[model samples]
Target: MSPTPSPESMLPLLVDYIVAWVLICTILFLGAQRLKAKIQFYAMQSLGLSVLLGAIGLAHQNTKALILAVVAAIGKCIIIPLILRYVKRRVPMNKGVESYVAIPTTMLMGGGMIMAAHYLTNHLFYNQSHLFNEMLSTGMALVFIGMLVMMVRKKAFTQILGLYVVDNGIFCLTMATVFEMPMIIEMGILFELLLGVLVMGILVQRIHDSFQAVTLDELEQLKG
Candidate 1:
């Protein structure tokens, strides 16, 4: 006789999890209306990712996942974004609205890139019993898209937010597994992110002083 289905076989929970994934994806693709809105969206995406990670952790009953869920939700999702908001108020970048690639065009291209990623990387060489294994691939795609945004965008501040998005995508995948990335390793990643953003701010100021504009196209002289 066939065995009784495990509680994990519940269809509603699977539906909810997929819905969470879709909701986070939507947040990532949402349009940025202003610098403040952009910060808010970044924060929202981080928060949503934390919750999703935590929910997945609870489903899997992994203690390490629980720890990651708490720390990430508080440290990154809550604290970093508040600091970014304050920084945003100080800098007040209007350049984010003036992306070099027009908004609609960027959105269309971003969607296409996501489709291409699925086509290229969705092929599995082994069994997919572990949920983290699936997340690793999608998380890599999300990180790639975030980097593409940073590369294509002209505004320094927008790129900073993309940096956070990329960081979160990779970090989420890291947390999904039992592998505990050492405390030093985590701190080093944080240090790099902070240093990179600080350098970006300095560069933005120099750009403003030199060109009276923030668009990177103004640095055309730097290229051969």
Candidate 2:
């Protein structure tokens, strides 16, 4: 009989699963219409990333990865979502946020970004394991998708969610490739994310109060 494969041996499969889910969440985020739905998708994506980090920690017996996973779960999945939900409740929801580009076009652009990421990863990580290259490419794709979301969406809330998506991509890359990222550096990144969210939330509230709209188009009129 063949010996059971160790958890370490299954790491690649686990990483692949999480990476796939993250990509799905990114797509859902792009397609979502309501601000609340976008926030939910971001939270789900963060939870998926935390799970990936936790799996890496368990496989490697790395306490830092485990702790970082906990922090990410609490900060990104729970606290951030709750805060965004509060802001959502306070903001007027009747206004529709039109995208700069159609959904189909945006999706096509996303696919092109993924292809570009794959090509870039191939050249940059030729010596790395196939799984590593795949994860890194997925991370890069997420970054591009996040930027697309920011560019296409008109709402300040959605734009903030896009920023979170970008941050998640960076986190995915760091955790997947350098599982040993210093705890202090991870904490600093988390702090910056939390701070940015809080500040943005305040700005969003002010914009809604002042302009009676939270759309970027409205804000742009203030540039004069």
Candidate 3:
């Protein structure tokens, strides 16, 4: 048996779900601490996002939004994995190991980012839309966290993951907080992410061939 949702209980939970969605995307984009873990996390996050979007669409009764939600699930969750598998077959990634910043430390910073986002969006940007602005703030924070992850981690593969997070953050900000963009816009984003992954897919081979070891840290010789 489940406890019923009071009006008060409902709103925060919804916001939390959106925040959780952002976190999932952030983790996906920020790169995983381990290779197998990152892949699994990405798949799980996409699935979670898909479910949330579907629920939001139904709850809000926005037919177009629901359709877009389904599209996100398919693209982010399934298609990306297939592409990743192909990439994996081609290159031996030197990333997916312990990071320079350390996972626990990065998490602490990420927590700080969420708090800062809330503080800014709540007090400074208070005049913004009452409904979705918080989500926007959360997205921004997640993007920033992803950026930090990229900066601190020297691995090229992880850097690409950071880029992925930034994309997801923007996508979430647009879809959840801003106006419901046309389906074409969402499709464009999916296409862009696909292209990025495809292009970077080749980089894996380049890294292995050039350095003989794929770690970006060793590539620092190029830093004249």
Winning model by lDDT: 2
**What are the per-residue Cα lDDT tens digits for candidate 1 across 27-104?**
454356566676666666667667766776677686766676687778676777676666565564563455677777
Query: Quick one: ranking by TM-score, best first?
Result: 2, 3, 1
Local distance difference test values of all predictions, in order: 0.61, 0.78, 0.65
Candidate 3: tens digits of C-alpha lDDT, residues 77-103: 777666665565556556355477777
Against the true structure, candidate 1 has what lDDT? 0.61
lDDT of 2 at 202: 76
Ranking by lDDT: 2, 3, 1
The runs of at least 3 residues in candidate 2 whose Cα sits more than 4 Å from the true structure, single-residue gaps closed, are: 1-8, 187-191, 194-224
After best superposition, candidate 1 residue 17: deviation in angstroms? 3.3
Where does the lowest 10-residue lDDT sum fall in candidate 3?
A: 24-33
Q: Which stretches of candidate 1 lie over 4 Å from their true place?
A: 1-6, 10-30, 124-126, 179-224
Candidate 2 residue lDDT tens string, 1-224: 98986866688887888888988888777777667777888899999989988887888798878898898889889988887777666665544446889877887888788889999999988998877797789889988988988898877667777777877878877875655457644565775577566656676766567565545666788875
TM-score of each: 0.70, 0.82, 0.73
